[model samples]
Target chain A: MIEVAGVTKRYGERAAVDGIGFSVSQGEILGFLGPNGAGKTTTMRILTGYVPPTSGTARVAGFDVQEHPIEAKRRIGYLPEHPPLYTDMLVRPFLRFVATIRGVPGKDINARVDRAIERCGLAPVAGRLIGNLSKGFQQRVGLAQAILHEPDVLILDEPTVGLDPSQIRDIRQLIKSFAGAHTVILSTHILAEVTMTCNRVLIINEGRIAADETLEQLAARGGKTRRIALRLARPGDGVEGAIRAIPGVLSVIREGGQDGAFVVETEGTRDAREAIAQAAVTHGWGLLEMRPITLSLEDIFICIIQGEEAA
Target chain B: MRNVLAIAWREVRTYFTSPLAYVVVGVFLMLSGWMFWASLVRFSSLCLQYGNNPYVFNQLNVNDMVVRPMFGSMAVIFLLLIPVVTMRLLAEERRTGTAELLFTCPITSGQVILGKYLGAAFLLAVMLGVTLSYPLLIMATSAKPDVGPTLVGYLGVLLLGLSFIAVGLLISAMTENQIVAAVGAFGALLMLWAIGWVADSATDTVAYRLNQVTFGLWDKLHLGLGGPTVGDLLNKLSVSEHLGDFRKGLLDTEHVVFYLSVVFFSLFMTQRIVESRRWRG
Candidate 1:
């Protein structure tokens, strides 16, 4: 439902969003992963028609954002980093206003607002002033407005920023629920958010797309190399060489400042733990601990970012 | 149009929900009421001074002495209060980042500017509407004033207030700081208000020299361009100069068009400034 090509945004000499391109199919939840100042928000703004791209074009549902902003924006619901809320307004009235401006049918405004309020868990504070709501509730209110019109595409920039763990979980669940019905592109620095809510991940660094892959593909990439931690009760020489001699074992590195502690790398396809434990016992190293290490999404993200930097 | 009304309604609701509308309205009414009472007192004293002479009493018209001065004071009051009303119209949207929500909607920038202008104009209308009671009260307690001049004077004030609002809206759209918008609008309006004085006192200034040259050219060419010189053009550009005909109960199309042009030009410029955001961002 979204196609972006060679989009670049510059402020004088500094390019906030360098030339980049990506597309999200209908009913796909694409997580925009990047560190701060990674041009994630700039790209979303260009797609939403809030800011024109300095060069190139972005389309939403086949409408070019710059050429047909009104039509393009009609199909987009954007939640900027600041939430774009009027603090003096009451929750219900604010949502109603958003619905009206967002072109929700007159007859369905109330129903749509009620649905959004309920969906975002804003029913309890429907009549209260938005200024009086807590940060989490305010963030939810922002989410409610973004989905109020039921737009075909939702561009959320850090939807879960500044929320507590529970609020983050609730928001993630809400985003996950949007899959297969609404095409979502939510940007966040939180790697776990992508793992928990998105089916596909697009890791960006320095205003460029570093890696774009499905969750399973990403997991397989991360899973190709296995790490195992080993601690010995008695210090011994040649422990690293002995571990490396085992089949499927890749390499071994001693943990600094720790006696008889080593980390072992092996091929992800085989079970090298039993072999390593047997080698430790025969070599009289007195193996005390042996555990396989699982690489998290964060580690993968860092690896991609670091790899991009290296290149 | 529905999009415009939606944005307009939001602006009005925001004004009323905060203390801004009430405080501005209350203070405006108090000051205008004081001006009305003071003018009434001066008119009464003048009537007493001329009570003995029928000729002098005939010349001391209530509309001239009372209503005209009252309208003049009301215009000045509007100049003071309109900045307060319109300062937050666009500035607050930028400050709070609601402009993102507004601009990203399926509406044009013209719709947003018109909606906000109409919203502030609605408040201006209400402020003028409540002061209608002043005319009714005058008719009750004293000799009836000329209704034509009084009603036309209200129209004049309304148009002038609208022009002020347009100017204020333009200033508001140019900045994110409300105080800066307010002060900038006040300064601009004051300059527009005081510009007429420059025309009136053009004795040895550049305007006088230009007026002399234009007059000599008109005389040499026998173009018969009577009654309009460079000074006249400067006076015509002054926002306050066009109110004289309305105050005198003469609905001159020229003055009406002048006020309308001011309204149109300011709003048009405001729309341009708003549209520039997408490009500059």
Candidate 2:
């Protein structure tokens, strides 16, 4: 439902979003992961028709954002980083106003607002001034405003940023629930958020797309080589060579500053733990600890970003 | 149109929900009411002083002495108060980041500018509407206040108020700071109001110099380029100059056109500034 091609947003000589291209299919939840100043917000703005890209085009629901902004924007619901809320308005009335501008029919405004309020769990504070709500509740109100018109696409920037743990969980659950019904593209610096809520992740670094892959594909990428961290009780010579001689064991390196501690790399398709244990016993090297290290999403994210920077 | 009204409705609702609408309207009414009472007292005293002199009494007509001056004071009051009403119209949107919501929505910049202009204009209308009690009170108590001039004077006030709002809206669009917008609009409106003084003072010197320069061309071409002097053009540009006709109960199309052109030009510029945001972003 969204396509961005060769989009570069430059301010003077500095490009905030360098020529980045990505497409999202209908009913897909694509998570945009990037650290600060990674052009996440700039990309979302371009897709939402808030700011025109300096170089290329972004199309939403088959309409070029610059050429047919009204039509493209009609199908988009954007919740900016600050939420775009009027603090003076009551929650319900504010939602109604948003619904009106989002082109919700007059007769259906109240109904749609109620549904959004209910969905976002804003019923208790519906009649209260938005300024008086807590940050989490205000964020919910912002979410309600974005989803009020039930647009086909939802572009949220840092949706869960300042919320407490529980509020974060609730927001992530709400976003996860949007999958398969609404096409969502949310940007965040939180790695777990993508793991919990999105099926695919796009990692951006320094105005470039460093990595874009499905979560399973990312797991498999990290799975190509398995590392086992082994600590031996007794000091031993040739421990690394002995471990490397085992079948299916790729290589073994002794860890620094620790006696008899070594990391063994092996083929992902095979298990070399039993063979290593047998070798340790025969050589009188007591196997104190042997654990396989699985790469978490955080590790993969940092690896991708740092790898991009290094290159 | 629905989008425009939605935005307009939001603006109007925002005004009332905050203290802005009530405070501005209240202060405007109190000041205008005091001006009306002061002028009425002065008019009654003048009547008593001229009670026996038909010549001065006839010259002291109610429309001339009371309603006309009241419209003049109201115009001045609007010059001060309308900026306050318009300062937050667009500036607050930018400050609070609501401009993202507005620009990203399925609406044009023209719609946003028009909606905001109409919203403030609605408040301006209400300010003018409540003051109608002044003229109505005079008609009830006084014997012969000309209704034509009074109504025409109101039309003038409305147009003047609209032009002020348009100018204020344009200034508001140029900045994110409400105070800056308010002060800038006040300065611009004051300049427009006082521009006629500069014209009056410089007319002879400037027009004579222009006539000297253009004398040979006019003599050669037999053209009437000498008709409107430099001062005449400057006076025509002054906002207060056009308001004089409305205060005198003269609904000259020329003055109406002038006030309308100001409104149109300011609103058009506001729209352009708003649309430029996408490029500048």
Candidate 3:
């Protein structure tokens, strides 16, 4: 339950967050994809009420961040890029302090702290000084603090930035599990995390949002195009002639090598696989493999940002 | 008010948890003890000579009085220790990134300031406590020595320290550097000390009329305390001046109000500075 309409943050001459707007419904996970210095953190800062937007407004769970900062901030849990930790205190004490300040009930404070500790896998280092903990543990402590009070919405920036692959997987799993119960808006430059964790993606580049939609929709959007790769055993001389006879095959270009493989380049909505397979079998060619080859999220992201810049 | 206490409590815990708290307390006590002993030795000579020591013999001698001479050293302690305490209050947090966590909490900016002030003030009071035995020890050796003045003198010094810490907290909020915060606070305190001097030197009657409003404290000690020496007014307006009155067993309601007012203004300013960083960041 978030509504951000025409929010722009300007610092002197540069517009850090150019007028950009998007909304996240309850139980929805939205991934913010952007390169470094792309205003992703700036936009998240505005949403959390940590800073005021230069123009327009953002509401968290129906409360305006500017007009009612405390109320809005209460309903939204935020983890800033750096984690904003008090390094002098221990991990458990720090989280308890956070819970106290967030106005969690004193009677339930211990239970909440234990729950957050378990959820973030911080039980082992509970009593260790925050400064003494490893970066990965510190990052977990940061996440633990954000979700300690169980806010209605969770806003995390670069949630998996410094973690190892296993830690990253663990955090992503935790984040994924949060979907459909907590509305989360996480920003990252990593494209794969978006495809895996967030159902919807919002691509921001050069201080503006260039693309926003579901993963499937993003892949399906833009010009109508498709590319496929096929592996087949050495075909007879009639292989090209038989493949050309398949309907909706724009160009059946014979691509490379003595292994006799073919990459059929097609246009528009059409599946030429059955015809290609039948043609190969009819000619006594071994049909080994056939798979749909589409653009990965990274390719899509690079293409989107590059396309906008080129335009 | 309660939230302010919670923050202050946390600040206090931080003092002990990090080396910051122990280091500040240690340095403060050592310097306070040094100043007290130095004042005691000078007091012995003053009592033995009974104002007969030649003034020109010692270039440092402003008077044979212990309080006045000690003021010069008190300035150094204020400049040295206060910056250390106030520097990390906000600057370290802003550097470490906890300022955002603090801001996002349910508490307001005002609570943060109050909490920081109280935490620093509590440590300072403990620092002041260690030096308490020195005066009590002073009383043990001499029956005629003024104990009332000694208690009030300590009271005045403590208030002066409170004022410095409060102002230092505000200056600490202005920048993220501990050294800059220390220097800014020292400069501010030094100016307040010099206001009466500048006011006193004005040749023009109009200038005198204008300086009165700015240097009212100068007038209060000279007129209100009704002392018998040239340094009497200077002593009252400068921290050391009122300190001497307390050492001499005098406590004025006006001096008490002056210390409290200074404390209130600095705390309010500290709150405002902390609040501005969010928009400016």
Candidate 4:
């Protein structure tokens, strides 16, 4: 429901978003991962029609953002990094106002506003002034406004930034509930937010997209070159050499600072556990434990970022 | 149009919900009330002096002596109050980051400008409405309040306030700081109001040309031109200058068009400035 093609936003001599392209299909929740100053917010601003991209085009629900701003914007529900709320307004009135301006039918305005308030868990604070609400509740108010009109696409920037763990979990649950009915592009620097809520991940770094893959695909890629940690009860001579001798075993080295422990780097998806076990028996090295180290998303992110820096 | 009204209604509600509306309105009414009382006292003193003198009494028109001076004083008060009313229209939105919500909405820049301008204008209307009690008091106590001129004078006040709020709203859109917006609007309005002072020092032809285009309401009192001339052109250009004619109960369409045109032009420029932010961002 959202398409960004070769978008580059330049401010004078600096490019905030350089040659970035991505798309989110209907009902797909795509997590936008990037560190600070990674052009994630800039890309969201362009998608929402708040800023015009210097080059290239952004479309929401098949409408060009710059060329047909109103039409495109009508289909988008945007929650900026700051939430863009009027602090002086009460929660209910504010949502009603948002609904009105977003072209919600007058007859259904109350229903829509009430639904949003309930969905964002803002019913208790509905009568309170927004400025007086806690940051987490205020963030809910922001999300409530974005979803008030039930737009086809949602572009949220750091929606869960300042929340406590429970609030973060609540917001993540709320975002995850939008799957398959609303196409959402959630931008955040938090690694777990993506893992918990996103179907696919697009990692942007230094004004460019560093990596884009499904969660499973990225995990599979990380598993392509595997590492294993092993421990032995007996100290046996030539154990490392014997383990290294196994086919598909790339290297076997003793782990420093840990006695009777070794790390094995293997090529491909081969299960070297059997070979290592056999080697331990043949060398009379008492086997203690052996497990393949699974790479987390954080590791994958760091690896991609570090790989980019190295390149 | 519905979107414009929605935005306008929300802004109006905000004005009242915050301390800004009450504070500005309260201060404005106090100043207007004081000015009214002062003008009434000065008129009563004049009445006493001319009570027995037929010639002077005939010259001492109550509308001329009391109502006209009150309107003039009220205009000066508006010069101060209007900037305060409009300072937060766009500037506060930008400051608090709500402008992003507005821009990302389906509404156009023109609609936002219209909504903000109308919202501030409505506040000015309420302020002017409260001052009506002063004129009603005169109507009740005096034998004749010269209802025609008094009504037109009220109309003149509203137009002048409308024009001033438009300029103030435009100034508000230029910056995000409320104090800066308020002070900047005051400076712009002062420049517009004080421009007529310079017209007096120039030679007759130059003075007429300068006052015609400069911002001063006093020039219309001196208007004797029967046809379009340099002086006529300059008189048309001054916002306050047209109020002088309305004070005499003239109700000229020319003055009405001038006020409306100034309002339209200012709002147009404000919309342009707002639309440019998206491009410049």
Candidate 5:
């Protein structure tokens, strides 16, 4: 539901967000991964209509951000990097105010705010001043405001920055719950967050889109080899030799375990479990556990960044 | 209009809830009260000198001797207090990053600037409103208190307050620092207030040209001039010049338009500044 075309934002001689373009389909959770100063926040700001891009355009729900700002903004729910909260305002009242400005019907404001508060788990501190709340609670308040109106598009910048582990999980779950309902584009420096919550990842570096693909595609393209961890119960010195002798097996290293635990690195994505299983049975090696090691987003991210640097 | 009211509502609530509001209102009332009491004491002692004598009645009317000067002094007080009331309008939002919320909302730049201006103007009106009891008491106790000029003077101060608020809002939008906003607004207003002084001292050759742009409440209408001259033109520029007519119970459309134009012009500049921020950001 969001389309960005050659969007660029410049401040004097510095280009905060250079010409970068991407689109998120309806109900898709697109994770924006980038290092600090990668112009992620600037891109979010331009999409939200908080800042005008120096070149090109961003459209939300088919409305160009600059030409039809009110219409475009009406369909967007933005949670800025710092939350953009009225610190002195009570949590509930602030949400109500946001609801009003977001074009919620006068009669439905309370119901909407309550729903947002509930979704963000901000009920207990709803009556308290925002400035008095802790950082994690404040981040919840920020999330609450972004989803307050249930906008069609939610653009969040570092939404889970200051939360505890549990709070972060809760936010991640909440974001995941928006699947098939709201198109979400969240930017963060955290690589693991994208792996856990995002269906697709867009890796940005130096104001450019270095990589963009589905999570699975990214992992497959991570490298040429597929690594698998195998744990055999029987003690056999020849087990490692047998596994490495199988075709497509590149290398075998003993990964410390009870015994006979070997990490078999293969040259391709083919499954070598059938070959290894037959050999294990023949040799009377008790086959215990075997699983393919998928590439984490961290590994994929580092690889992409390192490859970009090398290029 | 609802968007304007929503923004205004938040700003007004913030002003009333914050310590800054209480401190500004408290300090304003205390100072105005003191000025009121001093004016009353001066008028009363002067009354004693007259001793029920109708001869000196023409020399000392309550409106001129007490209310008029009190309002003139209140106008100056407003010059100082308006900045304090308006300094945080846009500066605090920018500093706290709430401008992102506002800019991203469905509201336009014009709405934000107007809402903030109106909120600060309303607070200034309340501040001026509280001090009205001084004139009300004079009307109740004094049989011959001139109500026309007193009410007109209040109107004049309101207009003056509106002008200050507009200017303050513009300066507030120019920076993210509240202190700098306050001081810059105050300094700009002080220069406008002091420009008339320059004209008065140099009323010889260059004064006529300088007088047109200077703002002061004490400037006369200069109606006797057959046509507009440099001096009359300068008199027209004085923001305070129009208030002088009001203190004398003269409601000139020209003065009304001048004050409104300043408010409109300042708010327009403020809107431009807010718009530029979005671009620069």
Candidate 6:
């Protein structure tokens, strides 16, 4: 469990994280989505007791990060953007070092580190130097270190920045599997990853939380259906008007372009293909392709960020 | 204490397992060997002219020759070596981002500092131990070596070495650059070593004021919390004063207290700096 109350971090004159507050309940994987310099890392640092917030307070696992730092920190695991790895040390030794510092007994250290190694899929590279490993393996080792202590809260900042597509998917599934045991707050710029792994998404932009809601809620609010491009062999025709009259068609805006196409913006579950088709037959107009446009997560991200800026 | 020891244990192990430790040991043996041989050759040739008799003013050259200056140069070596050893201690952690791991742990900052200090100090002691044989070689050949004073002198060097490592640890925590850490540590130890001369120099203009704050080992030869000599004064002021007594064959309690106090002070300062790091991180 974590509670952040009006947390803000400022460096000299620049505000890294402005007044923002959020909480993560037990067993919930909260996604912290933000563009670069959105103060996501700063917020994560405050939560993990790695850095003090310039103002406000953060509590993790019911302990105040400032007043009870060690206790708060003990409950959480943090994987920084860079992974905080010792390039020289081998994987197993480094994990043992982490476990030792976490107050794990020597006898239990080996077992815990082994379990972490297995959980993070670091078995083959357990004895190799972390610096020599591939980027994906290094990321896994970083993940191994974070969970070595079996912390209740895991804060991973940009966990999959450089991994390949398959590695990213594996990490995503691994993170998804970790949901029930550890309350994870992972900040990433990758929109699809968040959509795939996160139960809830908090879109951060320009040092403020732009939107905080579940995937469905966000999709409903910002996920307008595809704007259908209908081209007809007519100029200044009310075929667009009749098409607008169709059910589930929110609104239609026509544009001057090649072949005189009309941009139809829809707002419901209903696809207007049947209605538009019948209209074309009655109007005796030559119907070109009537493909329904699709908005990807990238489009939604840009829309949300740009929409926030405009507001 | 156990938590601190656990960290210290790991830190000590890292020293031996890492190349930094080997480099430090090799550098010390190579350099101190040169200095020791130079001192020995000077002692042996001078002994030929003096007829192996301890009667050159009966004021033996062990204090004036080998042990005394070795103690002084050890501080210089600490200046050179401590930064190299400790430069990456905390700074590399910060740069590589592993400091977060240390900070987020259940252990206290004091424990971390104490552990790191002991680990590093033990390493220096081991290095000192290797060179101990060289001094023993002198004792082995001497007709009637003043074993008491020679032991005292080595003890003095150990205490002085402790002070340098402690000072070096604090300086290392202040920056990310090992070079800067070395420079800062060197400058600080140099100032401590030269403080006696500076105070003596200032004795002309600020005699009244300098007498109160002047922590010179050479001046206050006797009087301390742990003993009657200036070594005892170390618990209150200048560290070298405490060490100087041990160099002269007096195991004053005050000198021991002085050295321990420095060790604790440096550890305390390091803890505060490491803890305060969270605010900036």
Each candidate structure's TM-score, on Cα atoms with residue i matched to residue i, is 0.93, 0.95, 0.83, 0.92, 0.87, 0.87
Alpha-carbon lDDT, every model: 0.89, 0.89, 0.79, 0.87, 0.85, 0.77
The alpha-carbon lDDT assigned to residue B246 of candidate 1 equals: 87
The candidates, ranked best first by DockQ, are 2, 1, 4, 5, 3, 6
Model 1 misplaced stretches (Cα beyond 4 Å):
A246-250, A267-274, A308-311, B200-229
Root-mean-square deviation of Cα positions for candidate 5 versus the true structure, in angstroms: 6.1
User: Model 6 misses residue B141 by how many Å?
Assistant: 3.0
Point out the higher-scoring one by lDDT: 1 or 4. 1
Q: Candidate 5, after superposition: displacement of residue B190 in Å? A: 0.3
Best by DockQ: 2
Tens digits of lDDT, candidate 6, A188-280: 998888888989988888778888888877766534465688888763567667888888887777777556788887765677788888888
Q: What is the C-alpha RMSD of each candidate to the true structure, in Å?
A: 3.3, 2.6, 6.5, 5.1, 6.1, 5.5
Residue-wise C-alpha lDDT for candidate 1, range B100-200, written one tens digit per residue: 99999898899999999989888888888999999899899767998988999998999999899999999999999999999999999999998878675
Specify the poorest-scoring 10-residue window by lDDT in model 2 chain B. Answer: B218-227
Please tell me which predicted candidate would have the highest lDDT against the true structure.
2
Q: Which ten residues in a row have the lowest lDDT in candidate 6 chain A?
A: A302-311
Model 4: residues with Cα > 4 Å off, grouped in runs: A232-240, A257-260, A284-286, A308-311, B204-237
Per-residue alpha-carbon lDDT of candidate 2 for residues B1-281, written as tens digits (9 for 90 to 100): 99888888888998888899999999999999999889889999999999999999888888887888898999999999999999999999999999998888888899989999989988988888999898788777854689898999999999999999999999999999999999999999999998778675564544455547886664566543345566777898899899898899988999999999999999999988888866788
Instruction: For model 4, state the Cα shift of residue A51 in Å.
Output: 1.0
lDDT of 5 by residue, B134-207 (tens): 88887777535677777788888889889989989999999999999999999988876755545544444434
> Tens-digit lDDT track for model 3 on A1-311?
99999999988899999998999999999999999999999999889887889998999888999998889888888898998888888998888888888878889889999999999999899999998898889999999999998998999999999889998999999898888879999999998899889999999988999998898888676336566677778666777677777887766666676667777766657878877878878787898887766766677788888864210
lDDT of 6 at A130: 85
Task: Tell me model 3's lDDT, rounded to 2 decimals.
Answer: 0.79
Please give, for every candidate in the order listed, the TM-score of chain B alone compared with the true chain B: 0.90, 0.92, 0.75, 0.86, 0.87, 0.78
Q: How many angstroms is residue B38 displaced in model 2 relative to the true structure, after the best TM-score fit?
A: 1.2
Off by over 4 Å in 6: A223-226, A233-251, A266-274, A291-295, A308-311, B52-73, B142-144, B204-242, B253-258
Please say which candidate is ahead in lDDT: 1 or 2: 2
